[model samples]
Target: MAVLGLLAGCSGGVEGSPVAAERWDPCSITPEQIAATGLDPEYRDEGWGKGIEIPDWGRCVFHAPGGTAYPYGLDVTSSEKFTIADARGRDGNLSVRELQVGGRDAHMYKTETGKSVRDCSIALEVSTGVVVFTVVYHTVDGVDSCQVVLRHVNDLESAIPAGPK
Candidate 1:
């Protein structure tokens, strides 16, 4: 979780754009969504919005009970910057892909550590902003990181309604 500790200040390559109040609360994700990722929704840190300003994005982390593994948890946040193009860039980068899930355009990236795959993220643009879901787990031997991320994306798409931007 050391990586998680230092990510609070990262831009994630996104430039902040004021999130319209009517479109997004900017710091809310249902406990059900957290539970959907197999983490204990009850033990959550709602401090994602802490020290975070508009457009850049606040992040939240959820973990399983008594879990000390590298990624037996999930990391989530939203950015006003569009990752659509960067996600679709095929110039030598082989891990990015464009996707259509729940009748919406999405981009997914598979991030790996050495020969072992670490995590994967799926991002979708809503009327409010870009919604990003990341799935993290230690090993992909029995668990598929990309599939896990896609499942979370599907769950989120059905739960969140696009708001006025």
Candidate 2:
């Protein structure tokens, strides 16, 4: 995937790729807002950054730029009702396909760069006016692209306002 290219470039170990360091800033994210949720958070300064917010439509979403290595994402909502969609992705020299996992009706998709190790998953759980989404991804080496996203979905979900009656 393009992310692999970016990731490869980040480590500066790959030949013929221009190596560069990556940095990220949160867009549309508020520390005060995140603090209000009361869920302990683990923040990491991965390259390309992340953003968390309650969109104008009243759904909470977290997004990351695909410009960096292992670019993937998740979006969740509780505006009309509790719902979630978690996604992981790579966007280079690879094919795109969708798969359904475990018959729970939740879906997962992968966008890769080449015929190499790329992986991702997304899930939702809701109860007691709370919605939780779990998203995960790893390379063939089992190294994560973004561990923060996996550890913080529950905290992010708790920040969403209750769904309608």
Candidate 3:
């Protein structure tokens, strides 16, 4: 009985552990930055919608210009509880590649349906956690989602706080 009790104690969960606060706010991206990415700031959606919230995450979605040739939306999510490794382990992520974006550790991943690339994301390492930029197309257009995501990352990389040296 003593040995069993010790084993159970070792398997106890870590409850009430505090997670680091997010270093960056997804909703804090300025309108000028949105315009630089060819997105309309007026169409930005906070938290994707009111009453929809993900614990430990800050999220915002920016829409492409109206009546564009290839319509799409960019969802920027920041989470102190998640890391680049967490993004790589996601079930639907494919072609996960580790790379450096503007001197910061980053991961690029995408989702595919048969031969079609559905969406792409770049997860950037930040001081407190990871900020993921995902570009999702509104239609089955031929535009490369990864390129679009990378462009946004480059444009906004300076805005994201750097991790520990």
Give the candidate number with the greatest lDDT. Answer: 3
User: What TM-score, over all chains together, does every model reach?
Assistant: 0.64, 0.28, 0.79
lDDT winner, 1 or 3 = 3
| Candidates' C-alpha lDDT | 0.63, 0.36, 0.82
lDDT of 2 at 28: 29
Ranking by lDDT: 3, 1, 2
Candidate that would win on TM-score: 3
Tens-digit lDDT track of model 1 for 1-165? 878778866747768886553333323667776677566777655445567555466466666555555355556666545444544563443378788888777888865445654677776766655666777676556887788778767766766546324
What would the per-residue lDDT of candidate 2 be over residues 44-133, giving only the tens digit for each residue? Answer: 232222564433223333434333343333433322233333222233312223333222233333345344534333333233222333
Candidate 2: residue pairs that collide: 1-92, 1-112, 1-113, 2-91, 2-92, 24-49, 92-113, 93-113, 94-113
Off by over 4 Å in 1: 1-27, 46-55, 64-66, 69-71, 89-93, 114-117, 161-165
How far in Å is the alpha carbon of 135 misplaced in model 3? Answer: 0.1
TM-score of the candidate numbered 2? Answer: 0.28
Candidate that beats the other on TM-score, 1 or 3, i.e. the better one: 3
Q: Is candidate 1 or candidate 2 better by lDDT?
A: 1
List candidate 2 stretches off by more than 4 Å.
1-61, 64-66, 82-150, 162-165
